[model samples]
Target chain A: MPKSINPAIRDFLDGRIWLRLHTPFTIEDINQQIEAGHIEIIQGIESKLVFMNRKSYTCNRCENTDQSKFTIFNCAKCEASCAYCRNCIKMGRVASCTELIVWKGEQPIYPTSHTLAWEGTLTPRQQQASDDLTRSQEINRSHLIYAVCGSGKTEILFPPIFHLLKQGKRVCIAAPRVDVILELEPRLRVAFPQTEIESLYGGAKPTMKASQLVLATTHQLYRFQHAFDAIFVDEADAFPYKADETLQKAVRKAVKPTKPIHFVTATPSDKLLVEAKSTGGISIINRRYHGHDLPTPAYISLWKYEHHIQKGRLPKKLTDWTNERIKKSEPFLIFFHHIGFMEKAEPLFQLIHPGIHSVHAAHPDRKTYVQALRDKAIPGLLTTTILERGITIQNVQVAVIGAEQRIFDKAALIQIGGRVGRSSAFPTGDFTLFHNGITYAMDEAKSEILKLNKGGGTNPDELPFM
Target chain B: MNCLLCEQPKQSSPSWQSLIAIEKSTLICEDCSNQFKRVDIIEVGDNIDSITSIFTYNEAMRNYLHQYKFLQDIALAGVFSNELKQALSKKKAIIVPIPMHPTKKIERTFAQVDELLKAADVSFEDLLIKTNQEVMGEKTREERLSMSRLFQIKPQVEIESTTYILVDDIYTTGTTMQHAALTLKEAGAKTVHAVTLIRAASEQ
Candidate 1:
């Protein structure tokens, strides 16, 4: 005999029955299975447990029994091709798995989930901020929520997003990088378990149907025409998007005429901040969620390196720096102005310290080398500007081999400096610049750091170097 | 006669157009025209004459031309073509827009003369093809004369050379058109003449 189960759980299990069974079932396992809706309990052992369930979905053209396998379902009504997979339905591409699990349903049709709730516990400030944003949405007033880096900005939007989803409003979160979209996907999935959240990017699932909520890069918004009720542009001052007019137009064109647009950034451009302040829509949350202070920048000059390198000699300053780090068994990154110069310096530096390893963009084993460095399998990495953003390594000091080169603009120099003193465990380290002469950009970057130090909103005690 | 080259009047030739004035001497106009002619004709490959422009690039003409080329005022190309259309209206030949090299077309977006010719409502054929050539060095009239045999006719063009008029944006020194004319003649043409948007006015 098997126990009875609720119809909703039974329906869910019926759709995904393969998840339930182990072939030679024990008596106890069978009873548990009946309770779990895997097998229906019968009154008599002699009577067979008949599996009775309606076909949830069927391919009209191929007549395939498995709904999960077919993405391109032929429609008998219009004789058109339709996507059955969730990703395919959202993005129109059959790239990810084809599990026909209903995340949400509306008016007897399965509606894709866009806005989801936050499952994790929120702090008092975050909860309040979330509530404030939700209330602003109800009144149709645009609000700018400015939170510091690592301030759980995404989590704070969950409650507002959930409210919007309940109200059947379409939302979109647009960022400048594909990496940011990828990071937000899983977090959103867990929060809106019932909502169909589509991650839209160059490589994301392709579909013709508009998703309720789309997490996309700014470029992806070009195809959307006033589709979203609320559009959130993350990292508003990030490169390519910030500099390009087409991307700005796409962001504007993707949002509905009467809907709200939210801009989020750690560093907003002067133009954007001015506009936000003038409109009185700006709200600032100046503290990190983890309550840590932003890192203070340090500058070092190795003027003798160029003179020694020209003479086919390694500078004592570089050798001594490496030797001390080796003695301390600490890892570091040697940033270079050009790949050609970096290649020349690599072999010579390796001769001085045989254990040292260098990697660059053109290296065939770049991924392996990066992984090795990340895993602390190598002593150091000699690299170009490619590794300047969106990558973090534990406890690694940073050195710019030719910091005075014109390529090291203020933004680039600041980003490179950011790579150092990031981890809380090893939050303080020496950031050196090996330059033949100091440049104006370097001075500007250092001055900007001093300005941030004096800004007063940041925690003064945690910035050890300051 | 006034010399076409130097614009000096010559007493030897009484006819106004029969004499060409050199810097220091007068040459007979027939002799000057013959000197400009080369026995060997250069072929305007099948892709080259697809869109031919008229207007000898000169200092005076270049001022307006810089506006068309650099400033991206495509409207000026239309104006230049209207002038060209007016010049060619007397003749009954199809207006072949000068074809730009594929690489040049990509950089410049649209060919200027092609747009001009089309705007003028003249019938044109995309017949000539251009093969890339290594620029040897700056060539003078004599050097260009010697190098006149370099261009070759593309096969299977089926051109009515006698009725076809070779068009180009400019006719500076008439070297390119001379070669193009020779090539058309080799492809069994009966007669060939050149028309440019501007002829350098006789200086004298």
Candidate 2:
């Protein structure tokens, strides 16, 4: 008789497909599991990843199909010139010869009962969206929560997530940026107090316990296969996911076959809006939960701002904005298009105030700097679009330096504007667009905010500040 | 054509060498080639008779070796083909690539030294077989020196009483080359000289 497979190994590998040998699992246990016919060994780089006729390769895990991204190296294991996917090489090199182990045994049952510890009531707008999402899950159709920022989008997701958990189904909330995942983990855990929730991101330790609710970055979903019964993509139109097709494929590949992928975003792409409309349906919530308008952005023309910053001088208008914020003792964030320009302008901004700092995606102290800003320890920060979303600071004034740059698209600008007026205690703040010249994106972003604000209730002049 | 190292389109001005060698186009561009810090022939003393290295292990060479050996960008083996050919062709000694352990060979796919020689279109003798699986790069200088004999002469292979030049991808602490040379000397080789692509600045 075959020996029983190890429960620990099974739980770890249950839905995590395409794991390399000895990765977070002992080789002996994996081999034993294989002997018991509870594990399946699949080729790391499936033949489907390669285009035979074109002499190109793709990464099966990340769905990276770019011809340039696939590289060939002499593989000792296969004894051939095997192709490996460079796109997801950081996770582990996936070559033709590498064996990916997956658990095909009896899946461990998750707890169907869960407790939502959150006592806060959802607004009527949020309730409507929540009901719409729960209805979409019943019919097994994809849905989009086209809600404005600070509109309790996460609260809307709670009902559907709870419904899925009651059915003993696994649910995933994936975001493109790690910030979003970090932001959701604590909230989701508090809300689903008794549920097994795990947050997966870069460098995160893998949990041995079988988690029913998975909050992961889109990049982390590359390791999963047919894992979640329902996957909700939070910040669906965010960076990397919006610009990269492979990330889109990763999200699709992560979900179980025929399962729906609901999207929750403040500003989704036109393609996503259309896809949702044609499929499950779109549920729009234009109002913030606080019942206030999105902070309308005011334009400030700073022509040759780069030249002035390069010359070790902040532009006059930018200096004025900084002075005003400093005079009011308000914490601020100045967004730049490029890191080089941001760094060049960082010292100039610091001249106005010594504690002002700069941050980018790869900045080593990004977490601390953001935390420092949140704690109001620093006066301000000059940053790239990395801080465009998922960060909430009370009474934080915002500015976009070089707003005319192509990087400041309508979606990005809208999200940046969303950064302000988030918390109800500080309902309104200044949002300045410091631009060299006006661009169509700027006009679209301003009009989009105006349209959303109008859709929320009434004219900003008509409504009193909360 | 794309440059073998950078994979960028080859953009190089025609020099007198390129003009004469019309059939042998440069595999890597001038920009990529300029990064290597070529050094003069330095004699590696002790058990080995002498050693010759083409380039010092500068940043570019380090990156090149990382991509070539670790990342398995095998096309990079041709980046210095012409230089290797020019250096090895003048030597009267028999070319013997420092052998990889059978398991390491499998892990690395093609033997790095063998591919370098193959890319240069130079023939070599497979006279030695590596016996141990320990990688020289991972061990400290002292640990590597004290490690057990890692190479053995292949069965039935004759080590003629002539000079044998051993080829390797990089020369670090020279422990690997010493072990390889000692094995060859014991197998009746007269003189053992080492040729490596890059010489790392020894760790002080």
Best by TM-score: 2
Q: What shift in Å separates residue A374 of candidate 1 from its native position after superposition?
A: 2.1
lDDT of 1 by residue, A211-271 (tens): 5668999877754555677888877767668876657777776777878888876556657
User: TM-score of each model's B chain?
Assistant: 0.59, 0.93
Query: What TM-score would chain A of each candidate receive against the reference chain A?
Result: 0.63, 0.94
Query: What digit string (tens of lDDT, one per residue) describes model 2 on residues B86-137?
Result: 8788779999999888877886677888889988899999989988887677
Tens-digit per-residue lDDT, B51-112, candidate 1: 23344345545544564454333334444444555556777664444455556554344566
For A126-218, candidate 2 gives per-residue lDDT tens digits of: 888899888888887999888888898898989889989988999999999888898899999889999999999988997888999999999
Among all windows of 10 consecutive residues in model 1 chain A, the one with the lowest summed lDDT is: A99-108
Candidate 1: lDDT of A303? 67
Instruction: Compare the candidates by DockQ and give the number of the best one.
Output: 2
Give the CAPRI rating of model 1: incorrect
